[model samples]
Target: MSSDRLALITTDPAVLSGQAVIAGTRVPVSVVLDCLAAGMSPEEIVAEYLTLTSEGVQAAAVRGAAGP
Candidate 1:
C-alpha cells in the first residue's frame, strides 16, 4: 500500500517523548526507513525488530517519503 498511510501513526508530545517514533516503541520512524534503505526486507525487519510488522514498515516508508 501507499506509504502516506503512516501519517496516521505518530508520536504526540504526550506520547513517545515527541521523538516521532512508532506508536508504541522507542524505535524511531527513521530507523525503519534506514533499515529499508540499507536493503533490509520487510520480513527481515520484522525478524530483527520483533516489535515491527511488515505493514508497519511499509507504512513508515510511506510516511518517511511524504516528508518535505
Candidate 2:
C-alpha cells in the first residue's frame, strides 16, 4: 500500500483528545499498535475490531512508527 493509503490515520482535538485514529472510527491507532506489539496480526486486529480495515491497520503501523 502507498503512503497515500496510510493517510487514513487522522487526528482531531475533538476526537479521542487528538489521538491518531482511523479516519471514520474512534479506534485509537495506539491500540492497534499495542495489539501488534502483543503479537496480534493485522488480520487478527481487523477481526477483533469490526470497524477497522487492513489498510487502516497498515497505515496506523506506519504512522505510529513515524512518531509524534
Candidate 3:
C-alpha cells in the first residue's frame, strides 16, 4: 500500500485504550480484521461501518498482518 494509505491507521491513548484505529475514527483496526476473518467482504465492512473507507480497511488489514 502507499504511505498515504498506511497513514490512515493511527493510535491514541484516549481512544480504545490506544488500540490502533482508523485515523480520526474510534473504530479499532482489529474490528476490521475480525470482520474479514469472519467472512465479511471489505465492501460489507464499509457498508456496516459507514465511517470507514476501503483504503482504511485495507490499511488496517496490512497493519494487523504486520504485527506490533
Candidate of highest lDDT: 2
Give the per-residue lDDT digits (tens) of candidate 3, residues 1-68. 55666789988888999999999788999899999999999999999999999998999888877776
In angstroms, how far off is 25's CA in candidate 3? Answer: 1.0
Consecutive 10-residue window with the lowest summed lDDT within model 2: 1-10
For each candidate, the alpha-carbon lDDT, in order, equals 0.75, 0.90, 0.88
> Taking the tens digit of each residue's C-alpha lDDT, what string does model 2 give over 1-68?
55776789889999999988999999999999999999999999999999999998988888877776
lDDT of 2 at 4: 78
Name the regions of candidate 1 deviating beyond 4 angstroms: 1-4, 14-16
RMSD of candidates 1 onward, in order = 2.3, 1.2, 1.2
TM-score of 2: 0.89
Count of residue pairs whose backbone atoms collide, per candidate? 1, 0, 0
- Estimate candidate 2's alpha-carbon lDDT, on a 0 to 1 scale: 0.90
Q: On a 0 to 100 scale, what is the lDDT of residue 26 in model 2? A: 93
Candidates arranged by TM-score, highest first: 3, 2, 1
Query: What tens-digit string does per-residue lDDT give for candidate 1 at 1-68?
Result: 46445754677786567767766666778888899899988899889998877767877887877783
Clashes, model 3 = 0
